[model samples]
Target: MRYRSSDEDSARWDGFPFREGDIIISTRSKSGTTWMQMICALLVFRSPDLPASLSELSPWVDWLIVPRDEVLARLEAQPHRRFIKTHTPLDGIPLDPRATYVVVARHPLDMAVSLFHHVDNLNRERMAELLGGPAPAAPSAPPRSIHDSLVTWINREVAPAEAMDSLPGVMWHLTDAWQRRHEPNVVLIHYADLVDDLNGEMRSLAAKLGIDVPEEQWPLLVDAAGFAQMRARAAQLAPDPVGILKDRNAFFHRGGSGAGRELLTDEEFTQYEKRAAQLAPNDLLAWLHR
Candidate 1:
């Protein structure tokens, strides 16, 4: 996503303005944002009978394409318990005492790769068509694969951070939330753990949310929100003109863990590791390694 200056005219957010006891779903993109949204829905609603599609249930709060005020208005309009989504780091949010924030982390390697594919689907032409707004100019006719776009964005996004010997803003994002993981009102979940142990993570999530559904219902909730199942449902269930889908049914992409490393080069890997070690805390990097 392009980072427009915070001065851009619009509600961009007058501060998170969180209502008391509302749940806020926040994370960097592709770091299990949708997955955590689903988990929170299950916990809050306490049933598999999800009333609306994912968008209605949990709306994006900081989508630059939309006016920030419009995003907040949509979230505020929701009658159900609010669970708004954001990719901004915690420093970007309202951080009010009334909200419960859940931050989900994916291995940077996997996150980078997943983000690459995600950008590919929003190619300039596709973005204009899907977003109904001006699309970025296309690159000079090279056959740009998703990986290329992902890497380019990372490079462009990282230059400032690299110049400053920082891990780039995205790494700072994960570290900030990781540092706050122990707060009673904040929950930190590992995407790999969710992939490896869905049931256990769901239970842990429920416990954090102060929910306690019957034990037998756990499997049913997990199955209902399974990647394949959710993707299948989303084809029809998602709002019209679904944003950034390569195909209607392929939105979930691959849900496996550690995919980012497989696509990374030795050099990129070395740089990634060096930057991560320098910018992110040792314990956080160690957690991702685990």
Candidate 2:
């Protein structure tokens, strides 16, 4: 499966080195990838202030922007428990029983809305500058407003797992994880669950990743993973050291869900539901939007 969006090549995972107890945080784009990174950072470092920038610490294994060898060298030197990130679905990458996989999911509607802001804010020219390559041509005009953007995104549908950031793509990622949710090594988490109970989710994740923070330092770790804290440290947390966005904070935009739900009209929402039904299992969809 070729995930064309953002030019990410999932093939890079072919030769990934997975040590025992390695943690893989697999998620659809904008579905709390950075949030999970922060949680893992606190858990691994056992400190409120991270040793290095979160992005530098947890590089997307499949992202093509950085050379594969460079990414490998950085991870190879890390002494702490390695926590790798991938936007690809479970089937897209190697599945090692010795490694624990954490798949984070968000409401498809909300994810699309978040992705809209994310794609629109991308500074590709800056990215090219950093890569020492000619800037790509400008993108076509985008939808003028959030409402229009939602309408456009919700109506677009690709095959399940076809693109890690599309409507069906989100469902496929969730479905794959849902199927293996009961497995000891694969844990599924919802964005809503994390938002509703940050500390609770963090503890659950810590247990899954076999990370134990001293009882006295639990609060510090929890507080550091909070949305506001991550936003406050956006520059350090955001992966774009090359000024990939016009505003770094924009990458950490609204953390809430249902933005697309509110923007979608009755008829359009009906279409969305129909499409979602065709893609995801009934129970999985129930847990997702709830």
Candidate 3:
């Protein structure tokens, strides 16, 4: 497959050194990327208090702001099983046969709602300092209300799934992963499933990643990944020590589905459904939106 890089430097997956048994956590943004990262950290370290922050332990390789060589060196030095994070879909990546790829998803409406707040948290000035350039212009202020935010988010269309950050782009990201979910190397996870049964899901993920935790240690790993514990450790789990977020706690806001459901009108909900149908098959749509 032809690989492409995003302006944000997310496409730097090319030429990445992949060792056997490496785990690649690929998911659309706000679709439980940090959740899965924490899970991997817990499973690998088998402790609630990691030696380093989650982001430091499992860095997003394609994030250009961090410096590609620095990220590579950190991963290479790590002796534990490496699990990397990426926002790109399968097609945009190298698709190594020797490594395991775990793709996570969430209900689209809920994801949008979470992302709306996520955008608000971003500190463009800090990001620009990291990039060593003039800070990008600040984003327009958020809508006066969440209802207005959802309406604007759903109606946005910069390109037809051209950028992975757009509404259409998010659909295409899920569509690519859904298509290859049956492959031996690719495993699919849902945010709703985690919220429903985190312990069960963590065990299942352990099996998928070929990690065998001692039965006694299971509780520690599961407990550490729970919402409350993670939220308490937000400074460590949050990737924005650079002050990208206005509030660290807001990053973990309402980690369940249905926030968007309550905010949408019947007609707006129908429009979202129609758009989903256009982007994916019925089974995938049902699985995603559920």
Candidate 4:
């Protein structure tokens, strides 16, 4: 399906509907969207009964797959917990005081690497089949290179998804939210912490929502949702999972940290840091550096 960009100003998000008890995981693409989804699912149901891909259970509300009205209507009609996925920044979303919003933070460098892997395995033929027929020309013109695509979208001009080479755009997206992390309802968790301390973060995530996961069950939940475990379980879970890209193996692609310093060049790091200094809050930048 071709995704149409909303000509409507993100400012009009006030008109977008949100409901009480909704748990919205809003973040830039590939920035731990699935990780937080899994965390939240465990918190809400206390059992990993919601399939492998959380997106199967809770779809991306803003994706072109479903119209906004249908999304709003679905939220309003649903009786069970509604945990929606979104790649839009916070301001673009209608704020619901009653909803629990989690915005996971990943180092821009790591996100870029993850996205690079994302493109490698996309298997356009498979995606074309998934989308039905030939792939649509990227909404914007085809990007000359990945970096060019990043330039196009930051400007919101037009660029092919392939051209969206995000050498530093990933940094821009992260820094933007790092600046906004102070918002009262937005909870920020670092990919590093989430990866390094999965058990701790899982427990912490549960506590943040006032959910008590019995200590013994933590092992069961953690084992079931671990990266390799989840990847192995993907086909069985079926449909789609949040964070798991269009392809199942894509989700488990190189989940690593400290990539910014290791993989990015001094030139690239400079570009990333400069953008952060200009747009990211000083405090958030400090957190990233740490």
Q: Is 2 or 3 the stronger prediction by lDDT?
A: 2
lDDT (tens digit, per residue) of candidate 3 on 9-122: 545777988999899998888999999999999998887879888888888876767788888999999998898988877887888988999999988888888887897787
- Per-model CA lDDT versus the true structure: 0.68, 0.84, 0.83, 0.62
Expressed as tens digits, the lDDT of each residue in 1-290 for candidate 2 is: 54544557788888888888888899998999999988888898999778888878888888878888988889999998888888888888888988989999998888888988898898878777766778887558754797876776666766654556777778878898999899989989999999999989999888878788789999988888888888998889986855678888888899987788888779989988888898889999899877
Clashes of each: 3, 0, 1, 6
Give the worst 10-residue stretch by lDDT in candidate 2: 1-10
Each candidate structure's TM-score, on Cα atoms with residue i matched to residue i, is: 0.83, 0.93, 0.93, 0.75
lDDT of 1 by residue, 167-195 (tens): 36667777778888888888888888988
Error of 4 at 210 (Å): 1.9
Off by over 4 Å in 1: 1-11, 67-70, 123-135, 144-167, 236-246, 265-268
Clashes of 2: 0
Candidate 3 structure lDDT: 0.83
TM-score of 3: 0.93
TM-score, model 1 to reference? 0.83
